[model samples]
Target: MNSQKCYALLIEKPKTFEESERYCETIGGTLVSFSSENEFKILKGRHSKKKFWIGLKQVNEDWEWMDTTAIVYSQWKERNVTRDVFKDQKCMFVSGTGDWHRENCEKKLYFLCKFNRMRLT
Candidate 1:
């Protein structure tokens, strides 16, 4: 649990959703997800009313979290998993309320990045 300070990164640029996701991975965070009320509050308070890019991707038009590497858990802005317009898209974002939404992976948006405990490997 002793991880280095993980700063929430805000990326406001026009890039593919995949690109955004990859950018966070490169830095250490994997897009922001509201898994708990506290986390939701923290991110919400920190970001206020801005939307940011996340690391969720749509495979075969289905939404999934790239961080979890599984489908059992969902951490997104929207409850509905299917997006007609975003089906082909492969990136997600965090709305002001800490909800997830599918948008153009290449669209410009503020982003939230997370830094986890450095791996011991």
Candidate 2:
């Protein structure tokens, strides 16, 4: 496996969750997913003050990432109230304040793509 670090691209144009996912795939990546708090903080610092879709969505009764990683860490705006509010809003996004919120998957919004390119050893 390639040991190169994952990188991200912030797409300014707004798109629905599916649209954003397709766009990222065309460029050989997937929507961004947070694997750790430090990674999230680093990206949050660079992409602060902007709302962007992340690779998280509810599937059945559980939320998961586009990359198929198990959902671990989350930055929900209101952790206590999210479960009730997330009934209809299945997709997750990072708000301008770097807090996460759920919304309709069809709602248009900017998105971030995560990728790891191969490197010659």
- Best candidate per lDDT, number? 2
For 1-121, candidate 1 gives per-residue lDDT tens digits of 1134355665556455666677888876777544556555665676677877766677675666676644443456566656465465566676776666777666778777777766577
- In order of appearance, the predictions have TM-scores of 0.67, 0.87
Residues 15-42 of candidate 2: C-alpha lDDT, one tens digit per residue: 9999999999998999988878888988
**Model 2 lDDT-worst window of ten:** 1-10
- How far residue 32's Cα lies from its native spot in candidate 1, in Å, is 2.6
Where is model 1 more than 4 Å wrong at Cα?
1-5, 12-14, 69-79, 83-86, 118-121
Going through the candidates in the order shown, the clash numbers are 12, 0
- Candidate 2, residue 19: lDDT: 96
Residue 18's lDDT in candidate 2:
94
Clashing pairs in 2: none
